[model samples]
Target chain A: MEEILQLVVFGIVIGSIIGLGSMGLTLSYGITKFANFAHGDIMSLAMYIAYFIVVDLGLMGPTVFSLSFGWGMFLAIAVTIILLAIFSIAIDKLIYKKLRRDKSNIVTMAIASLGVGIIIRAVVTMFWGPFARNFVPGIHEAVPITGNILIKPDQIFIIALTIVVTIVMYYLLYHTKLGKAMRATADNPDLAAVSGININNILAYTWAITGALTAVAGIMLGIQAQVYINLGFNLLLPMFAAVILGGIGNPWGALIGGFVVAISSEVSTAWIATGYKPAVPFVILIIMLIVRPRGIFGSNI
Target chain B: MDFLIIENSYLLLTATGVMNWFVGFLTTFAIFAIMALALNIQWGFTGIFNFGVVSFFMVGAYTSALFTIGPPGEYENYIMGFELPILFGWFAAMITSGIVALLIGLPTLRLQRDFLAIATIGIAAILRAVALSTEGFVNRARGMNGIPRILGDVVSGPDYKWVLLAITLTTLVIVYLLVEKITASPWGRVLRSIRENEETTKSVGKDTVNYRMQAFVLGAMIMGLGGAIWAHRMTSIDPEAFNDLFGTFLIWTMVMVGGNGSNKGAVMGAFLCCTFWFGFPLIQESLPDILGNKVFQLREISIGVLIILFLLYKPNGVIPEKPKISRHL
Candidate 1:
């Protein structure tokens, strides 16, 4: 039972990260109507940007509350988020926008996104090289929650950040006028345009929002694990699985789906070899595709 | 004797070791061409989206290697090493790949193309993971080595590559002709019809799903064959070699750039892309270490850019599919 509890805690930490990442993907799919295969690469790019600022630039500051990084990391995250948003918008203008103007199909869009992903990965590889890096050098001890159940402060920080982000996301999607327009555009672009919504503006905003989310998720992942080039690419499948499970384009559904997938996969580690952990999400994805492809919450934007 | 003299001058280019380079280049081209042709049959002819081409290739290569390698010695451990002839290994590779395809296709083929693509890629990743993780099964991450080469006894050293090249060309020509023949037949027409418009094909009383399954399975079998050929050429194999970047995406680029639904385009695409792929090393040699180190990254970026540019400008590819004119008309 204690072991299960520990696993559950670990699962929640991972799930929150996945849920945050999936929200970005789901939003991109919602507005763009194609799986932005570059989403994960973009996340990796953000993490590398943060690493460059924190590590390479010598922006050292005192560590806070058992978390690995210092004030520099927080600043890095902020700067990275802004840069990522602009970078994503630039990518849209460069690649996706042209394809969209050509009236390309979803498959074409997906393929283009894949190309964008490859380019991003290659660029990251060029700059950072293939080796892994860390934000802080030392290993931090886990804080005990109960008998044999322990949680890291960083994990707690992640969960807290997720909850806060989720609340903010709710407000943006439900209460704000721009959010309404965004939802309108996602639902039926033709209808949305007929009603005088600037589709281009919505797209830019959507990319920006998703890009920001990707920054947070990527940084969290970096803190939880190690910063590497393949980091984002590796997480791409699981994020897709989470998005599909929660229902594409539904943020809340994605959050729940993220938790479900993470917990299930983490629990399965009890039986299966740890190396096969990556396969678990895919197995779930396959089963979901066969059983309920529309996803649990359905494809509501 | 005159033919031999002419052959050495024309084909060998022995003085500059150009023959060695050319042979290696062509061999890689032939293997990738076979795989690209398989993609052409699936996506080009049948419109069956498969993003996991590498998985089938891996399955085929490993199956053949396992079949022919001698029983595991002390250092290495894996499942089967029947010590069969290389011919049996190749045949077994095709059959195994086909069966794997059938199993994977049955569940996912009935769904959307996205589902099929995702499922295949996911499965490919899983298979690689399995190969890496299963220590007792496939010798873990160390991978198998020293499988007997084809015609190992008869041919030796520099002479052997020529024989291998001849065999590869023969296999390529046979596969090419077979694909061309199949695509021209009435069944091929049904597959094309499904690609163009599945609903219309269904209305015409054809079992679209069954036809798709057949195409998918057949294409996978061809990929398996390509994998087997590649394994024998390399003489050793590892899980790392079977990645999506090379195994799936590159093949997609070749097919798309060559022109979808055209077998000749597939072959031409493979040839050109392989040239671009292999030409990098030559370019790298001219530059400093720091600059040369970035060549791989540059190559991948170029491929990505190439894919996007092609999709935007020439989506149909270099050799666009020609409409078949009825003979009676």
Candidate 2:
């Protein structure tokens, strides 16, 4: 029972990380109407950008609150989020904007994003040299909350951060005019345009927000694991699984789906070899596609 | 006279080496051409989004090897060494791939296009995970080796390379003609209709889903055939060799560059892309250390850039699909 509980905790930690990534993915998909294969690589790019700030820039400050990374890492993450938002907007202007003007299908956009993903990965590899590195380069100690229920302070921080981000996301989507505009555009681009909502502007804002979310997810992933070139690419499937599971365009669905996927995959480790953990989410994804293509929450933006 | 004779001998040897290299190049080209043609059927003609091309390729390779590798020795710890002929293995490969495709496509083909893409990516990842983790199934990380080579008993050395090249080219030609023929038929027209508009096709009483499933399975089977040929040529199999980037995305690039919906374009794309992909590495050797060290990465970036540029500038590719004209025209 304790072992199962421990596994569940681990699952939830991983789930939150996946949840964050999926929310960004779902947001992008909601507005763009195409699955952004590059979203994972965006996360990877964010990680590298943060790594540059904290490590390459020599900004390693003291570790905070039993966490593995320092204030420098936090600063790096903030800067990366802002930079990534700008980057996403720039990319939209450069690549997706042209495609959108051409009125290409969603599959074409998806493939283009796949190409973007490849380029991003290659850039990451070129800069980082395909090696694993940590922000602070030390094993985070796991503090036991109960019998055999040990959790890392870093893990707790990740969960708390995810919850806070979720709340903020909720507020933004519900309370903000930009968010309303974004949702309206996602619901019906033709209608939105006819109604005098600037589709392009909403798209730009969507990219920025999704970019910010992707960066946070990437940093959290790096903190949980280690920063590596394939870090984001590896998370691609799980994130997609979560997004599809939650509902393609629905942010809340993605958040919930992330936890569902992560927990299922993590817990399946007890029965199967640890290496096959990736398969669990895939199975869930396939089954979900077969049974209910709309996903658990349905595809509302 | 002695000096002249020596020079002639050296020239002869060099000629033979070049011939060997050319043959080897064409052999692999034919293999990829076959797979690209397979992809052309799925994505180009049928409009099926199959991102997991590598899964069927891997399955075909492993299946053929398992069927033809014969019995394992004590402690070898592998299963299903049927000791069958290579021909049987090839058939088995195609059938297995088709079945796998049917299983996956049955549900997803009826859904939105995005579902098929998502499902394929998932399947590819799952298959890879399975192949890597299951020690008893595929010999784990060490990979399956010592499979019997195609025509090993009769052929040797340089002659064997030529023979294998002949076999692959023959298979490629057969497949090209087969798909070409089917795609020109009424059945193919139905597929094209579905690709153009599924709802319209359904309204016309054409079973769009069934047609898609057939195209999907057939394409997967052809990919399997290509994989079986690849496995036989190498006489070994490994999970790492079937990386999605190489086996899947590169094929996609080939199909797109060659121009989808054109059989000749697929072959041409395979030829062009393979030459750059394989031949560029040789050029990398002569490059300065700084550039040479990152040649592979640079090539990857170039390919990505090429894909984006093509999508933007020349969406239809070098040889865009020709509109079907009336027979009188």
Candidate 3:
């Protein structure tokens, strides 16, 4: 019973991170109408940015904020988010924008994003070598609750941050003019353009926000495991699985789908071999596609 | 006499080393050409997005290795293996890979384009993870070593690679002719129609799903064939060799550069890209040490830049697919 509780707690913590990762993917797919295969790599790039700041810059104790738990996280996340947003916009302008202008096929765009991902990965490999490094210093200390359940401060932080971010994202997407513009564009780009919704601007904004969210997810993952060039590549499958299972282009669906995938994968590892955990999400995705092709929350493309 | 001596010696060395590298490049190009033509059948003609070509290739390598080497001795983990003849082993590998593809495609083929891509990519990753964990199968991460050499055993060590190279070229020619014939036929026209517009084809009473499955399975077989050839050439196999990101990216780059819908383009792209890939590293190595590493990084950056540039400037590829005209008119 205690072991079950522990696994549940751990699953939720990891599930939150996956949820955050999937949100970025779903949002980008929603507004851009192209699956950004480079989305996972963007997360990896952001984690490296935060790692450089925390370790190389030696800003652990001397940051503007007091070294309190909440303040330290706030600073780290803010810096990471800002840098990621800038990087995403630059990538959009340089690669995706041009591809979009040319009216290239979606497959071509997907391939181009893959090229971008390879370039990013190679650059990271050259700079950091092909080894893993942790962003947060020190091991996670567990906080006990009663005699059966215990949680790490990092895990707690991840859960809290995920809840807060999802709420904010939900609000932003539902109540804002920009959100409406995004949906309008996604539904029908030509129709949205005819109605004077700035499609390019909305897309850029979606990419920027998605980029920032991905950075948060990546940093959390690095803190939990370790930061590496292939970190995003490894996560690419589950992230896509979450998005597809929840319904492509549906952010809320992605949020639900992420937890479903993460928890199911973790729990399955107990029964099946650990190496086959990735197969869990894939199996779910295949089943979902055959049973309900539109996805749990997706509209027809 | 002194000048002639130095010049002749340098030329002789250059001739030997360059000739070997050129031959190696040709072998690699031929293998990739076969794979690209297979992809062309799916993406170019049928408009099916299969991001999991490497999975089928891996299956082919493993199947062939297992069949040729027979089962592991006592305390070994992998499944049944028979010491089949080389020709039979290759045939079995191709069939096994095709069956795997058929199984995967049967259910997933009904999904939308993007969903299909995601599903296939997931399947590829799952296969890699399984290979990594299945210790009894393919010796896990330790990989299979000491497989029997095909033509290499018959030829001298130095000349063995040349023999394998000849085989790959022969296979490439066979694939090229087969693909040309298929694409020129009525079946190829149906694929093209499905690619141009799925709904239009459906409205015209064509079963798009069945065609997609056919293309997908056929492409997997070709990839398997290439993998079998590649495995024998190297005489060793590992899970890592098949799962690298560069493996898929290189094939996609070759297909795009060659011409997505043209077999000739696929061959040309493989030759050109493989040469560039091999030659660029050497060029980087010749520079001063510090500068050389920097140049290597720059080369990677250039690949991304070139992909973007090509999409913008030549979206149809270097040699665009020629539209077929009817002689009856």
- Listed per model, the TM-scores of chain A against the true chain A are 0.97, 0.98, 0.92
Tell me the DockQ of each model, to 2 decimals. Answer: 0.74, 0.73, 0.61
Give each candidate's interface RMSD in Å.
1.1, 1.1, 2.0
| Pick by DockQ: 1 or 3, better one | 1
Q: CAPRI band of model 1?
A: medium
Residue-wise C-alpha lDDT for candidate 2, range A123-216, written one tens digit per residue: 7887778789887776678999898799999999999989999999989999999889888887888999999999889999989989999999
lDDT, candidate 1, B1-329, per-residue tens: 00111223333345546767787778788989999999999999999989899999999999999999999989888999999999999999999999999999989898787667777878898999999998878887888898888888789988888898888888999999999999999999999999989999999999999999999999999999999998888878889878878899899999989999999999999988888877665566567889776988888999999988999889989988899888899
Pick the winner on TM-score between candidates 1 and 3.
1
Cα distance off (Å), candidate 2, residue B212: 0.9
lDDT agreement of model 2 with the native:
0.87
lDDT of each: 0.88, 0.87, 0.78
What value does the interface RMSD of model 3 take?
2.0
Interface RMSD of 1: 1.1
Considering only chain B, report the TM-score of each candidate against the true chain B: 0.94, 0.93, 0.90
Off by over 4 Å in 1: B1-14, B325-329
Provide the DockQ value for model 3: 0.61
Clashing residue pairs in candidate 2, if any? none
Give the lowest summed-lDDT range of ten residues in model 3 chain A.
A62-71
Given candidate 1, what's the lDDT at residue B329? Answer: 100
Model 2: what TM-score?
0.95
**B145-190 per-residue lDDT for model 2 (tens digits):** 8888888778997679888988899999999999999999999999
> Just chain B of model 3: what TM-score?
0.90
